[model samples]
Target: MSSAEDLQFKILQHPNPTSPEKRVELMANPTFGRVATDHMVMIRYTEGKGWHDAQVMPRGPLSLDPSAAVLHYAQEIFEGLKAFRTKDDGIAIFRPDANARRFRSSAERMAMPQLPESLFVRAVDELVKADRDWVPSGENASLYIRPFMFANDAFLGVKPASEYMFLVIAAPVGAYFSAGAVTVWVSETYTRAAPGGTGAAKCGGNYAASLLAQAEAKHHGCDQVVFLDAVHHRFVEEMGGMNIFFVFEDGSIRTPPLTGTILPGITRESLLTIAKEKGIKAHEEPYTIDQWLEDARSGRLTEVFACGTAAAVSPIGAVRTKDGEVKIGDGTGAGPVTASLKESLIAAQRGQANDHHHWVHRVL
Candidate 1:
């Protein structure tokens, strides 16, 4: 196996790139995860050969054996981040290093070989550079990047596969949700993850398990679903795809703690750091659903929001449960604290504010 520094990416131009006029048409009203770029990056891995055959090639279908391990055992992991068109007319990816670290952590949990963080980051950088034109420039618009890995071994045994594939593909996207605040549905039927489960890992199975609950949320007329802890099913865990936070009248905020049952969201972490910098008194503690309702009804809870790579600081306008609905902050829109944190995070991501932590990685 070679050092991470020794791995070189082979760049291949797409023979049939999207025409500029069509690209403009696509970017004009890009929806979430709908409009894809022309090229993608791929890297192959084998137990004996390590990681090799890296290429930035045309975006297309993949060839997997019928008995591939990933198809049977669900040994797959993935990550999502965005490339922002900066205020200074450049391109930057927010916290690729953090995403890289999480990717390795997810691979370890899935009993798969870990790719070097440098290689993971370099692959994303290569793809973003190749499709820089796809990075949209506007409010709440950026190129959403997806980096994923899957077991490719043809063996169907109940063990870790020796061969794997890593890939990065990007899409130009607008806001994940429609304008204004979003309503949430709390699920009592399905739980996302239990203790010592894959809840902390960014793997596909975790999401596969939450699909039904998400559908239930849609059935109940809500924008998203919230899951509770598996044991008591009382304490709030996280939303289907994002982390939840609560704002109070005392100018303090609280979010559910990470006890191996919730995904440690990058956007959530950034908001916490920004809150601390602004002296907002943030606490990563557990809050129960009953307490959430009480706080909302008593006017103690000022605002609630969900944060993640895809959603990006969305305010929770109301909470819907079996009993009834609890409106958050008049059920209108983002409160002051939620709005301020989002502004700070977005400014830093787009290189319009002081990047005190150097979170943004410049690519162009």
Candidate 2:
């Protein structure tokens, strides 16, 4: 086993690259996670060998054994980030280092091999460079990057796997939701994560468990589902796949604290940092559903929004519960604060704003 710094990536060019004209057509309105680039980056890990066989090759089907641990036990973790076409006609990835660190944390939690941060960023950069043309140029459109790892041990067992596979794939995508604020449904039947659970890890099992609750949200005609804490089932934890933030009428914002129950979102962290730089008082405190409904109805809570890598910042207009529905700030669209924060974050990500934090990692 060697350090990730000692590894070199082998670039295998795509044999049949997509034609430029066809690429343009596909990038016109690239739906989320549908259109993938021609090449992918893959790195394998073994117990004794450490990380090896790193390559950026063609994007295609993966061959796994029938007894692969991930197939049965679901020992998998993944991450989502974006590569944006900068304002100067260049491409940049927003905070690959942060994502890399989180990937390592998730790996540790899932009992898998920890990928070196340098190697993680290098793998991402290799793939992005290989498919640079796939990066779409627009305000809302960017290449969505996905890095994932799964237990590859071909054995029937309940313990951690000795073999693992890490891969990075990307898709040119547009907005995750339609224009306008979204409505959310509060799920009393399903809870996302609890104390001392895998709620904080970005693993497949967490999402697989949320699918049914998300379906319940859809059944009630809402865009997303809001989950409460597993212990209390009253305090606001997080949305299905994103972190929730609340803006008050007094210009103060509060989001649920990371009490080992929510994913520490990169976008959420960036917003909090931006808020502090701008003198916007933001608090990470626990707020219950009763408090949320009461505050929204009493005109104390003015705006609400969800943040994540996939959706960025999406305003949550109305909240629907079994009792009834409550609208936040007229339930029309993004409030002034939400819109401003989103604009600032996107500007920094796209190289349109001053990058005081140097979060943007330029690949081209």
Candidate 3:
């Protein structure tokens, strides 16, 4: 990774940017994915020429070929991280370097050119700085940044494209979901990924494949769908978008291991580290659906939650399966351990607590 000083950015201001007052109004009650900032970052890559033409410009549509590879072949990848207005009125992004490293890994897996980690972070910083006013400081809001790349080739071949476009767009978003504990549906019908697949890669195709399962979940009155292992369909893997954690009354927390079948979530890692500091035992091991059902029914399982970049942490109260329902800890709301860990994590992100691991990056 190159140092911050190695990356230089060219900025082009937007002529008709949103005014401060209107920007504030949008941020006041921003939905999760609707509104975006005025400017965005763009970079291009060619097969041999490598990455070039870094620019921060106004947000707009792109012109692509009728036979663009991404439109058909789906050679695309993306990443999500956030910029926050810290408790002290300073802007900080939580562990953007981790996101950058993961972005490179995803590109390598998708057979695309790697954007240098420093360059990725620099592009994100340039865009956020240009639209710094769009960063929301509302009660449960922040600036959500989405960085993505797609094959831009106009060829009709099955091979990797020769050209690609990388861009960063940001939006001011409120909480990912309601604050109450969520209900999830377990899908025995569809599997997210197998042992050797692109499950760990943050690519668009993976998500595209899960939409049907998500719709099935909604049909059952559940907010998300839980996927089982592709082999046995017994072991609990993850939710559609977030990682699942099982918390027991014994003060032990276990999440599914990274067996190349689950996305390695950054929030999942941070909680494990913080759990250890709080004297909570954390394990990355397998726990099957049968075991989960038995434990929750017997009161051995105290709380369950999901973690990701968008929501940080969400308490899982009840799970609806074809077998029946499994409620955790009276099925109320966030549990003690869940609440404590979330508070610590969010506080660290906002610079309210001591950043012992130095994860917060103040780009401004």
Best model per lDDT: 1
Question: Could you give candidate 1's per-residue lDDT for residues 50-147 as a string of tens digits?
Answer: 89899999999999899999999999999999999987789999999999999999999999989889989999999999999999998989999999
Better of 1 and 3 by TM-score: 1
Candidate 2 stretches greater than 4 Å from native: none
Model 2: lDDT of residue 302:
98
TM-scores of the candidates are 0.99, 0.99, 0.97
List model 3 lDDT by residue over 1-364, tens digit each: 2333454567899999998888888888887889989999999887777787788999999999899999999999999999999767779999999999999999999999888898898899998899888887876778999999999999998999999999999999989989799999999999999987999999998898899999999999999999999999999999999999999989899999999989999999999999999999999999999999999999999999999999889999999998778898888799999999999999877877888798999987
Candidate 2 lDDT, 217-260, residue by residue in tens: 99999999999999989999999899999999999899999989
lDDT of model 3, residue 53: 77
Ranking by lDDT: 1, 2, 3
Relative to the true structure, how large is the alpha-carbon lDDT of every model? Answer: 0.95, 0.94, 0.91
lDDT of residue 44 for candidate 3: 83
**TM-score of structure candidate 2:** 0.99
